[model samples]
Target: MPVPAPTLAAPGESTTPVLAAATDVTKSFGRAKALNGLSLSINAGEAVGLLGPNGAGKSTLISLLCGLRRPDAGSVEMFGRNPLDPKSRLQLGITPQATSVPQTLKLRETVDFVAAHYPEPTPTAELLVRFGLADMADKQCGALSGGQQRRLLVALALVGRPRLVVLDEPTTGLDVDARETLWQQLRDYRSQGGTLLITSHYLEEIQALASRVVVVDRGTVIADGSVDDIRSHVAISKVTLEARCRRRPSTLGRTRSARPLRAPERPPWSPRTPTRRCAGWSATASNSAASKSTPPPSRKPSWHSPAIRKPPRP
Candidate 1:
């Protein structure tokens, strides 16, 4: 399949490729295939969202790019060099799914150690506050909540002043305020000409930040292109509107129909919530009804819903 160059600067400014994977890269564990000939690329100052369902080889590819493990076949490169090269360590930053920030150490101490590796490092104070961990600087990582811990992990990744950052579900446990704050930080990083390869199940987040997306499954690149192009491939958008007036408008820009929603017994499952998916959208809406009837239309859901929906077959 044809893959478009990521949404980015004119091709001339590319000093060297930031990320490139090619050929039939495959990993087999006896009977299971983790990644198969997964060819992909990312450019500097660009954000590429690597999306796939569970066991889709996203994390495995990240590991190969970071040199955490050697690929069983094919090849992966960063900055036009092999990730196994010691030099790649200095140019890459990674925020893993689990909090890698050492819990036994004070947050400041951990950051200082990592920053010491860079000639020019981002100020620790700025990153600490931006990630909501300023007041907790002296506190040990073990004392933090899941959200705070995740924030610390982000801070560590940025302190190294990397050329390319690989983030694996970086916002997994953050509250709304914290999550938005990270997005702003990422925008700033990209604006400064940093390259980012991110894997997120949050499709909305991908839509908001990624200029290009690579959908990988069973170790293969199933689709790769701009977000608009991918959405065009599916070619339909779903529109659902819920308002405080107790009656939804008949149409919300091509909406075929609207369903009257009922209050849910609980919210949806979220790692932070300690409840089920019921605790997520459900509880939020239930609480909103008294202070405010319903959530305002979400821009992500509004545009992305129909785009991912498969069109009716003739």
Candidate 2:
């Protein structure tokens, strides 16, 4: 889908002020902590990307921001009001990782249904066309493909014309084209002074859209800065190599310095070495006599037998 270039907000339009904040928030599941003393704040018209690996608590923080869950300690506020307050969330929109709409409902009907909940919403027809769902307007949600359904899920979030939108892995299963389309829509929203909080594992996703990036790992923020600043701090490159060699490598690549192993090395195995040395001369003589009597077994010339012998169990 091709969208017209988004117009920039007027000077004052972009100054809508801080919309959400999570101060020293901590949340846990059973004995596992999901978020620990995390702090974040977002203002109107800013696009902030929450970057993290799996199980990094990005979702937990989002749940608290959307008022679906509460922090065990610290606080979360939306528009200076508790996130749990209905009025505070009126200006918020969310598209969680998984979404389910009435399977039997037509796409158009679903949009209309969601639109009815808000006092003022983007026109249903306009929303549908903007999201490239005009052709599937009458199709049942269940009949749409996964990509189409994902587009609809995100479209519904914008129906309320929310000032702040929170998308969790919004393009998780989308193709390149679908993902780009969604990105354009989000860009337009931010261009019009809307605040965005998006969490994704794809670095390209964050780099393309986020002015500021927050990297989370093991339930805490590890890096927070403008996208460029964060990139500068993490100026590392990844390289992969494949080669055939008889010996294992002590280092991955010759271009990089290698650190020696810290642990002590074990002694090498040898066929001639006995399991244990005889404690005394009598014990040694008895072992020597037994070895002489048995004689050394003859070596097999080849291991090319049709059936190989299984090793004896210890």
The sequence of per-residue lDDT tens digits that candidate 1 reaches over residues 132-205 is 67898899878888887887777788888887888999887666677767777777777777777889765556
> In each prediction, how many residue pairs overlap at the backbone (N, C-alpha, C within less than 3 A)?
19, 0
**lDDT against the true structure, each candidate:** 0.63, 0.69
Error of 2 at 204 (Å): 0.5
Name the candidate that leads on lDDT: 2
lDDT of 1 at 230: 48
| Model 2: colliding residue pairs | none
What are the per-residue Cα lDDT tens digits for candidate 2 across 138-181? 99999999999999999998999999999999988787788879
TM-score for predicted model 1 compared with the true structure: 0.71
TM-score of each: 0.71, 0.72
lDDT accuracy of residue 95 in candidate 2: 90
Error of 1 at 214 (Å): 0.8
